[model samples]
Target: MAQKYKYARPGVETTPWNSLDVRVTDPFGNRITFTQRLPE
Candidate 1:
């Protein structure tokens, strides 16, 4: 499955940890990824 979203307004700067990518695994061994990209 695939998903996407957007934010109209964003901060000037964001923390390092704010951007994260988490890998999720299902019982069948399928993997999904979640990521967050901070403001520029």
Candidate 2:
């Protein structure tokens, strides 16, 4: 019996991260926010 294996795929659609936002609270009752923006 022969074994089948998958190789690296070609012509994969690539997309960029547009933006992101995150918020967090610390133990000292503090608020934190992180924002990121990417170019098209």
Candidate 3:
């Protein structure tokens, strides 16, 4: 299935392995992808 959402207004913090999961439907239903780099 194509991803319908990406990114969220999380709490006060976020990590690469953590997800806020707040979803809103995209009218266009376009696929989106995001990458979070690990801390160096």
Candidate 4:
């Protein structure tokens, strides 16, 4: 799933590009956040 998301672009209805936020919850009830920048 992460591989697919890496190449995905923001949809037309979404906000302007600056950064992307990704959140994931593990089975152990731990929450993780990821911040990514758009490619040049």
Candidate 5:
């Protein structure tokens, strides 16, 4: 999935990790991939 990061105010910067894909496993042993979009 494609991810995007946004800043709440002007002249703000976004981090590299904010636009990356993250993988996690659940208790049922299933792998899930999701985007990490964060606001600054």
Candidate 6:
């Protein structure tokens, strides 16, 4: 699920992330971040 977000655009959306979060920046200078809640 998280893998898809790596190439996501401004309008795209997907399931939230887990412990292993991911972030990336495109050539257009757009940044996307995927994060999830930590275990209690």
TM-score, cand. 2 vs. native: 0.44
Task: Report, for every candidate in turn, its global Cα lDDT versus the true structure.
Answer: 0.54, 0.51, 0.42, 0.55, 0.53, 0.56
**Taking the tens digit of each residue's C-alpha lDDT, what string does model 1 give over 1-40?**
8443232222344347676566566556666666778665
TM-score of each: 0.44, 0.44, 0.26, 0.44, 0.37, 0.39
- Candidate 5 segments whose C-alpha is farther than 4 A from its true place: 1-19, 36-40
Worst 10-residue lDDT window for candidate 4 reads 6-15
lDDT of 2 by residue, 1-40 (tens): 9553233222322335666656565656576666677566
lDDT by residue for model 4 (1-40), tens: 3454433333322226766777666656676666777675
lDDT for 33 (candidate 2): 62
lDDT of 6 by residue, 1-40 (tens): 4455544434434434435455668867778776655564
Superior by TM-score: candidate 1 or candidate 6: 1
Error of 1 at 13 (Å): 18
Better of 2 and 3 by TM-score: 2
Residue 12, model 6: lDDT of 33
lDDT of 3 by residue, 7-32 (tens): 43223334557642333334565434
Measured on C-alpha atoms, candidate 6 has an lDDT of 0.56
Segments of candidate 3 deviating more than 4 angstroms: 1-25
